[model samples]
Structure formats: C-alpha cells, structure tokens
Target chain A: MIDFSNPLHLLAYGVMAAGLAFDLVGCIGLVRLPDVYNRLQAGTKCVTLGTCLLLLGVLLRFGFGSMGWKALLCLWFIAMTSPTAAHAIARAAHRAGYALWKGSVGDRYAEDDEGRNIQPAAAADRPKEA
Target chain B: MTALDVLMLGLALGVFLCLYRALRGPTPADRAVSVDILGVLMVGFCAVMTVATGKDLYMIVGLAWASLAFVGSLALAKFLEGRSFDD
Candidate 1:
C-alpha cells in the first residue's frame, strides 16, 4: 500500500521494504544453509545490511532531531560490531574443529589453522612470478 | 494495524524463527550464530518500539542493548571455542 502523495512516506516505505526483504532472505539462508560457517556468513552480512537500512529509513522519517541521531548511533554500533562478532564466531568454530560442509571446495583454514590466513590453495601452490 | 505494527509483528516472527534454530541447531557454533542473530533481532524490536511509541529513550535502550549483546556474543563464541571466557 504505497501512498504517492507524500514523497517522504514513499521513501520510508520503500526503504523499510528493502530492509525486510534482506532480513527475510538472511533468516531463510540461516535456516537452509549447511554448516556453521555458512550460516554465520548469511546471518552476519544480511542482517547487518538490513538493520542498517531499516534504521536509516527511520532516521529519515523522524528527522535527526529525535529518533534520527539515535538511529544513526545504533546503525554505526551494529556495523562496527556485527562483523567482529562474526569473525570471532567463525574463528572459534574453526578452532573447535567444527566440520565444514561436505561440498566445501577447499580449506585454507585447514592449511593454516593457527595463523588463520584464508588464501586459496592455488595461491600457495603457484610459483612466484619473480 | 499500521505499517510499524506490521513491521514489529514481522520482527517478532523472525525472533521466534531464530529461536527455533537456536534450540534445534546441532552444534555449539550453530547455536552461537543463531543467538548472535537473536541479539540483532532484539535491537530491531527496540527500534520499532521507539518508533511506535515516540520515545527516544527506546532508541537509547536499543543502543545499550546492541553493545551488551555484542559482548555476550563474543563471550558465547569464546565459550564455543572451549576457553569459557564466559566463566
């Protein structure tokens, strides 16, 4: 139900719709994806982007005077922390020896467990150009 | 219900869905991931409340909740790693 009369309303609704779409997609991916690493990837990236967009819409609607600055703060806080938590979770999972999905292509983590460098196998295999 | 109400309903549904995943997830890491998502959902819920109620304080609640959730998730991940920094 879009109201074409007011541009602000239209913009707010559109942004909220996009955010909800991302949220739904991320949740579905979390449920459907195999393995811890894959779930983490889906949940972290999609939710962060979705929530940020959702808050941005709120900020725009409410204007920076009231809900606006608070929305900005929440968005920034989530952006800073979500990825760090995701990295921590993934690293912890790998450290705890959580099994990768059977269809996983390769394991740079397997090759370099402690150092946690996630380069492709070919990079390690190829000779230096020099 | 208005758009904000609808959004809140959807967020609540998402929370329940994630809770199921957290409960039924096989491994510790799986639960941890879902739980982290739950914290984000908490923030969403608070934000919606702020909008619907017109209380800027709810947004502040959401902010404080977000950071606390992050700390909790970090601790959970550490626990999953078996170091039990949570303890």
Candidate 2:
C-alpha cells in the first residue's frame, strides 16, 4: 500500500507522466512518418525506451520483489528484440519488392542485393539455340 | 479511494485505447507495431494494478501475456509471409 503523502509517490507520478508522454510521442511518429521503414525507426526505438522507463518507474515504486524483477527482465527482452524484429520486417519488405521512397537519395539494400547476383555463369558455354 | 488509484485507472483506459488501435490496424506492420506497444502497455497497466490492488499476482499474468504477445506477433508476421510455422 503506497502512502500518497510520501515523496516517493510524487516521484512515481512524475515517472509515469514522463514515460507515458514519451510513449504517446512515439505514437505520433507512427501517425506522421513518411513510410514504413521510417515509422519502424521511430516506433521500435522510441517506444521501447519509453516503456522501459515506465517499467523502471513501476519497479521503483513496487520495491525489490518478484514483480520488479520480472518487469526489468521484460524491459530487457523488449529492448533487445524489438529492433531485431523491426530489421527483419524491413528486410522482408525489401525482398518482397516494396519500393523505397523515390525522393530519397539512397538505396543501400538494393545495391547490396544486386551486388550478390551471379551473372549467367560464363555466357559462352555452348548453347547456341535462341 | 485514492488519487493513485484514479490515475492508475486512467492509464488503464489509455491502454485500452491503444489496444483498440491494435485490433483495427490497417496493415500487418501496423498491427505488429501495435501488438508490441500494447504488450508494454499491458505490463505497465498490470504494474499499476498491482499498486492499486495491493496484490502482486497480476504482474505475473502481465508478464506471461507479454511473452505470449511476442510469440503471437512473430507467428502472425511469419504467416503473412506465407511461411509455415509447423515445419
């Protein structure tokens, strides 16, 4: 049972507000972003950080307990996994031939994938039928 | 009976709002992102519920849900790609 009069309670409130604010801001990025890849950049990284802070606040208020530990572990798991998952999604999108934003100057994945293609193994090999 | 309880309840409602977004999302990617966010929100909601209810048990359920949410999202995304999970 938390004592609302306790200063620690104030800290908890502040943490919750800040963390939720960050999370909502990340959502705004999702709504406003130009493309899926760009949205992934905002959504995965920012939301993970926001939720981690929120969990940390919960941990602080709840004290050292199983729940606290579980929260920390969950935060760590999300921090590691979310970005990797986003990367995988992006790679899949690319492979499925989703075009990059045309006005954008760069296409690194296209270049890298093209570089790996094997041009018809020595074109001269005795096949004159056309 | 308290301000913390009120605020926690509000957060829970906010979480539900996020959940609505997750369910009706327009794209697989949107749904995936929402599921991931919603998992964290669920954890946050459970933590606050623990505080509000003075019971730690809900946190365990929340954590378990988080794990399951991850697996479910991964499988859904795989399914979208026409990949078979049974293999």
Candidate 3:
C-alpha cells in the first residue's frame, strides 16, 4: 500500500492522476475526432505524454531502484518512438489516399509534392538555354 | 478504492474506448491508429501495475511492449502505403 502521508507518494499519486486524465481525454479524442489524421494527432500526442508522465510517477514512487531506472528507460523509449510512429502513420495515410476532413485548413504535404513534381516538368519544358 | 485502483480502472475504460474505435473505424488507417493508441495505453497500464505490485518485471514488460508496438505501427503504415518492407 502506498503511504499517502509521504510527500513523495502524494506527488506520485498526483502525477499519476494527471496522466490518467490525459489518457482518458486522448481516448475520447480518438473516438470523437472526425478523421484519421485528426485522431492520430490527438491520440498520439496526448497518450504519449500521458504514458510518459505515468512512467515518471512510477520513477518517483520507486526512487532510484531497478523499477525506477526501468521506468525512466520506458519513458525515454516511448517519448522517442511515439512521435516517429505517428509521423509514419500520417505519411502512409496520405500516400494511401486517405482524404482529410472537409474542415481541414491546409495540406502542406500535397503542396510540397506538387512543387516537387511540377518543377522538374517545368524545367524540362523550357527551351535549351546552353 | 485507492487512487491506484481508480487510475487502473480509468485506463481500462480508455482501452475499451480504443477497442470501440478499432472495431468501428471507417478505414484501415483509423483502425491502425486506434491500435497504436491502444498499445500506448497498455504501457501506462503496465506502469501502474509496476507501482501497485511493487514488481520490477512490469517495467520490462512495458518497455518491450512499447518497442514492439512501435514496430507494429510502422509495419502497418508501410503496408497501408502499398510498398514492400524494404522500401
């Protein structure tokens, strides 16, 4: 049983509570968001941070023990990989022709692709200058 | 119930929500994203378990799960992109 009277345990509980809140919100977003991209943004960012905070709480509760060290390791791994996976999923979704929500404001990826695809064609169409 | 118990219950609810999304998602991408989020949620569950049980093994499990989940998400994304694994 956690000793709530201990300041460290209280702090850990507080942190864990916050993490749970974030995770809950993220899951709600995942369900309620209009599109895949929107869901990805909400789910990935919020849940990643939530899980990291949870791990941090574990580290706090356990101090410098093996559990604490491993919690820190998991924290770092999750922080590093979650965003990378999100980015990859987003790119793949775009490439798979998953359309954005109608309310989406911009598509920089499409614009960038247009620029890359058009520039070469425009240059090729230009008369030989040399 | 203790705070940890409440936290764990909340996580389980979150997992069920993710499961709902995964089941009802309109597209493969949506399902993939839900599953990815589910993986992250499981890590939090493991972290809580580690503290609750005073066991270090759960931390190792969480670490392994995180990495495996990451790789699985990436593979699913690649498959969605219609490319070979090498590409």
TM-scores, all candidates, are 0.87, 0.75, 0.93
- Give candidate 3 regions above 4 Å deviation: A118-130
The number of clashing residue pairs in each candidate reads: 0, 0, 0
Worst lDDT run of 10 residues, candidate 2 chain B, spans: B9-18
Clashing pairs in 1: none
lDDT of 3 at B38: 93
Fnat for each predicted structure, in order: 0.58, 0.15, 0.90
TM-score (C-alpha, index-matched) for candidate 1:
0.87
For model 2, the docking class works out as: acceptable
Q: Per-residue alpha-carbon lDDT of model 3 for A1-130, expressed as tens digits?
A: 7796799998998999999999999999999999999999999999999999999999999898999999999999999999999999998888777877878776666656665663323223334323
Q: How much lDDT does each candidate structure score?
A: 0.81, 0.64, 0.90
After aligning candidate 2 to the native by TM-score, how far in Å is the CA of A33 from where it should be?
Answer: 1.7
Rank by DockQ (best first): 3, 1, 2
Model 1 DockQ (Cα-based): 0.61
Q: Using TM-score as the measure, name the better of candidate 1 and candidate 2.
A: 1
Docking class of 1: medium
Q: DockQ of candidate 2?
A: 0.32
Model number with the top lDDT: 3
| CA RMSD per model (angstroms) | 5.0, 7.2, 5.6
